[model samples]
Target: MRKRGKYIIDKRMKFKRGYQRKMILKIKNDNNLTWKNLADEFDVSIQTVMNDWGREFATIPYSLGIRMIDKYLSKEKNLILSYWISEILPKKWGQFLAGELNKKKIKIPQESEGLAELIAVILGDGHLERKTLTMTGNFFEREHHKYIETLVNELFGLSAYNIKLKGSNALQTKFHSTELIDFLIKNGLVLGNKITNKARIPEWIFSKREFMLAALRGLFDTDGGIYNKQKGYKRALIEFQTHSPFIRDNTIKLLQRTGFTPSKSASNNSSIGCTLACNTRIQNQKEIHKFFNVVGSANPKNILRYKYFLKRGEIPLKDKIYKEICRIKIIRPFKRL
Candidate 1:
């Protein structure tokens, strides 16, 4: 029988929880028993064990379900997949993950004891993932963190603190995005592909900025042309680090105060920009897509979006304009902190 939503399990999965929970507590109380021993018995990632360590929660089972459950139980796949995606298999992708590969492509793995969590973050949905496995395993603070430090610096030329911006993605703010992509490719961690026959759009890659963006510092006003076709397809992604996320909000507030009604609607390549200038995004995406879809067509919406972004950069001084709206906020050359 099919399960509801994305979480169906063998009904037998419920066969043991209370007893296992008691045993887990017992094991925690035993001073002589090591986490290594318990983790081995449970057969879960060390990080999972640590996350559940010293914490009382719901039902207990053979393994901490943290690493595999939410993933497999979701829309993506199922545990039956473990049959093929395991260390001991005829075709072992795990062997490649064992690290130190002397081969072509300068390959990166989907999972690694050293890089699993990392690969997850970079190519992942770019959202927060909770894993007791990483927290209690104690590996995150030690190894994972160090790897992040190097990854952030080498790829973005920015630290965890600087990479994030007030907006969720780079094009969402005022940051230079093409520069960031060049940095990531130079470091060889993520991959970008060139999509052709697509209205002169260039390479595209999954995003990582959302996960790393800080809550406070945000990009308020996007100086360049905005996209209406693909909301986030712009090559450069704006991101926010640890600065106050309020910056963008304040700017929005300021814009409202200055009588600029943050108008958003679908425009064509002319308005949204078809060149590399509007590659990534600052949202206003309906316009970006509409622009592309109408690149050569007579579609009115596409024409509007395209035309909106291709305007001259020159800003004419008006008698009614005030100081705050024209004020260039303090923006620094981003360096990995």
Candidate 2:
């Protein structure tokens, strides 16, 4: 005979107490304890819990529902819902949601957040067509959205470039980070953010390691106006090339392109490119104005620029820009610090 405890794990009666125990363990470990807590813990949307019919189960006055759930049971919601689903809902439903969590690129694993990103990736050509996890059956039934396309076009602006950027050549690679992560590793995910003695990268960027490295290289190649300090350097991969002693002798050669050579003049320009011009930024002028003079304006897109320099600081213009043109434009030992 199978042993039983406060919780049961089986095809029948849904091993609810067991589910609650597991979900509760996840809750205690979560640092922020925001909705993200429940989403990550139970791999479901915070909205789902918010919408969970209280009258049907956890009896509470109508007026008290939101408050009771949001304020009082907020911490318990993760556990309660896990209990309700695993114990209350049909056992198959529990497996269904759990299975959804297993799909790659399920973005946040909460109903809306993950769904939004997944749809964005799908319509943007960021995800592959898969029968494993779909928008029709398990997903569509839960989320009553009209169609998946609206959010994709409205948010991601999926274009040839985006598709190309997110695309992969890996035999089984998918465009979106979620699917890519799930597909490649059984339980591994790219941590959205990492904090270390030396540095911090903005946001928890859970995805494939290959993609993470690609993003790093992409940030260097494009401009996202991302500033490390802007996100407190917590949400970004901070790099200050000026601080490196190998400013020219080693790194400049590494950054050089084919048939190109680093010179004092080149170094000056590269230095200028990285300037945030904090000293001269006039009050009230939006920080975005710094890119007004970049030659292409259209090549990398403003967001790319924002991502690269984001939180770092405002860029210098005119005179300062010209001065850096002198330093790394390709000619120097800097002759000075």
Candidate 3:
């Protein structure tokens, strides 16, 4: 059963209780209007104006308040809007709007290793909608999601909200900011469907080896997987697979440029929309070790799998892998950059 609660707006957009009453009375006197007149102006019921606003029984919606200020108090509109933003809106919403109103006040970080990694993460598992940036991952990698939350906060001064998908083992971290979206687009990320846009690594990332490596780490952590090749063979394989040929080709080039020999393959199956799986793999055990040592992994699942492979010379079943990870403490918290 669903529990009843206050309206979402009432909880999200808070203001002093009697504020509506005070504003309604002032507007009535200054405009020489009756309760009916105000209700007609706002297309609301007379009871809504008199009982709700006049008797201080309910708070006015922000949109209604803005309309009142604009139509009746044009001279003080700016002042009143400022008051609404600073005093009525939630603190986080107010701060976000304030930053948007004055872009200079927003601290958009310059190019750095952290930023590069973020770009790769977005490329690997993120989606850019109209005004939101969302990244989804397996629920088993909750620790990695926490790390991404911290990384986003440290880099962009924005808080990411997590939502667990119903009926699935997936978790999503999402935030909405047009400025942030524009910043990402300016930094080479496409705004719509990435596969359609043919998204590739930003050229500037190649300018620095550290930036490239950080990006590689982000990509591998999000999209790459590691496991033993065969039940009897003591060999591990690190592989990255994507539907975007551009991304797969670029990833192979990136691995090669980073001094690792990576093999590539592709397969197409019409059963699943005929999407081609563009795959790149580093099959050499020595290179896999070097990949972990240099590029590293942010996802605890991947790290645990690699550690288990190193220790036992083979990967175990899913449940056993989970049990193994739980037995030892291996997740490294993300550090601020």
Best of the candidates, lDDT:
3
lDDT rank order: 3, 2, 1
Model 2: how far residue 17 lies from native, Å: 23
Please give, for residues 254-307, the per-residue lDDT of candidate 1 as tens digits: 223332333322222443232332222233444333323321211122122233
- Model 3 Cα lDDT, one tens digit per residue, 77-144: 77555554335655345346665532432359888988888898999988764356778887777777
| Candidate 2 residue-wise lDDT at 39 | 40
The backbone clash count of each candidate, in order, is 56, 65, 0
RMSD of 2: 17.6
lDDT of each: 0.27, 0.27, 0.72
Question: Candidate 1 local accuracy as lDDT?
Answer: 0.27
- Where model 1 places Cα greater than 4 Å from the true spot, the runs are 1-23, 62-337
Quote model 2's TM-score: 0.24
lDDT of 2 by residue, 202-280 (tens): 2222233322322222222221122333333333222212221222222223223211222332233332232321111
Model 2 stretches astray by more than 4 angstroms: 1-87, 90-179, 184-217, 220-337
